[model samples]
Target: MKGNSSSLRVSLRLLSAGLVSEEVIKDDTKLVGGSGLSLCDSNDNSKKSETNKALRNHQVLLAAHLEEAAELAAMIQGLSWALKLVVKSIQFFCDDDSIILDYVTDKVAPPNESIVVAKLLKQLALLQTSLTSCQTLPLQRSDDDINSSSLIKLARDAIASQTTWHTNTEEYETCPDCYAHVSPRHKLEVRSGYFHPICFTCIRD
Candidate 1:
């Protein structure tokens, strides 16, 4: 469930106050210590009682949020099917170069997610070719996976193929025109399909 900004802010504050793991209080039992309601008295035990109950609710909320975060991280790292679903949401990032670099990399990929991972890597490499140098980055976050559906694409893509012995062709692979090495590899993308994949630099040149 999505939380409003105020809910999040309030939750963070309560968590900071060290009350996150407490169970939520049931609304049935409140302090009935005072007889005649009079605002003039400082010992309004009902008010203090109310405050305590509210605090517990906040604690339960914060604990739920933290649990969600841990669950997401675990799911992203553990399951391969979920990781595959993650690829659609993910994007690659390069340095501050004023260009949109996109390319295909069928380049003799493996059987598993490695093929998809290769596509992703090839795309990034294609992008980097446009600039002097750049780094490949994954924008999708593995910070929320309680449902285990959030980062499944990434997990699947991460394990497309098993890691094994490699030649310079596989590890420090790059376009023949430019010897620029790919930083983030093992993850490729095979989306939109391509006839002949070309690195961005090669295309521009």
Candidate 2:
């Protein structure tokens, strides 16, 4: 995720030695978390040319109103996945967000509660202790590096293949048309098919 937005896409890579594993994680306020991993190994010199396909794309959801919060949440989720894969050192590469980057790298205290949840702060603290190295760096958009561009394409492709869920919970519901969270206070309209809820913005449009 990037800029002053509520939701965006994330690209993550797991690099071990010279081998690389990749994933595109999509973020939204209305979704939940799911991820997978793929590992590649060389068994024969002749098979070294073969590549292991990237693993499953991830969908991470958080109850956030700012893109910074969503971005931090994505980092947390990605770190958790890395830990599961027995990775002890991690370096995060994200769009320039100095405040969040400083907090993640321990250059400063926790960020504001509004931009970073208190609960998530605690989670990040714990994750930090679990890893030997957890550092953050600004992503480089350079001619020599095509990783960022490729990851963006991967994210778009993943989104095209998936459909949003239209369901209701006690606190919030998802608008079938826009796929944004519909808070209880927002006026909702019930559509004919499956009785899915639609938000006023979608209704107006």
Candidate 3:
């Protein structure tokens, strides 16, 4: 797929063998997911409806990895969902070289391949159809990077809990630029720790 420098960037980190964390950082603000946190942690019943609405609008699937290659498969699944959420193109970063090669280079799978490989291929196809342009690259191995370390911590939490973390409506925050309270759909974040909500208006601007 073609690469667009203006497209939103999403960082996908494999926390553990079975856990993954996805994050978008914008203007010093961070939006995090796949932490396995509940959405309805609040006691107010009035907000429950709002939370539900958010849940329906922003959905992130959390699944446990059963096979060795499940992490790559899960990443592909995440990309497929992201394509539906954002209008502009998206760039995905992950540390797995094998998975990157599998998707970027159209390699034919041998007969009797593992089920995880098959699933990855299927999700990759879906992602291609949904995105106008996409790019997947390897993540820099850096222990000092705050974003990288934070994602690792989130993944550790998910693995310890042994559960899948889905999108919760309450997780949405107001975009700093648009001043509208919405889910994390189409948000933008920078490597310098800047984060803001991205709406159609902001994207156009």
Per-model C-alpha lDDT, please? 0.24, 0.43, 0.38
Per-residue lDDT tens digits of candidate 2, residues 24-127? 21234323222222111212111111111222223113334344444455456556656655656655555554466566556677545453345555676788
Residue 121 in candidate 3, Cα distance off native in Å:
2.1
Model 3 C-alpha lDDT per residue in residues 1-205, reported as the tens digit of each score:
2223233243222221223333332223322333211111012211111000111112222222233244444455455444443433444455544443455445546235454455655666666667666555455557325544544444344332221123454455445465554455555542233223355556667
Candidate no. 3 TM-score: 0.41
Candidate 2 regions with alpha-carbon error over 4 angstroms = 1-64, 107-116, 143-145, 154-205
Those runs of model 3 whose alpha carbons end farther than 4 Å from true positions after fitting are: 1-68, 96-100, 107-111, 143-145, 161-205
Q: Where does model 1 exceed 4 Å of error?
A: 1-150, 161-164, 171-205
TM-score of each: 0.15, 0.44, 0.41
- Tens digit of lDDT per residue, candidate 1, span 1-205? 2323332221010000011121111212121110110000122211111011112122223332333222222222222211222212212221122111121223233335333333333443444354332223322224212212322332222222111224556543332234343322522433232111224555566
Best by TM-score: 2
For candidate 1, the lDDT comes to: 0.24
lDDT of 3: 0.38
C-alpha lDDT of residue 138 in model 1: 23
Ranking by TM-score: 2, 3, 1
TM-score, structure 1 vs. true:
0.15
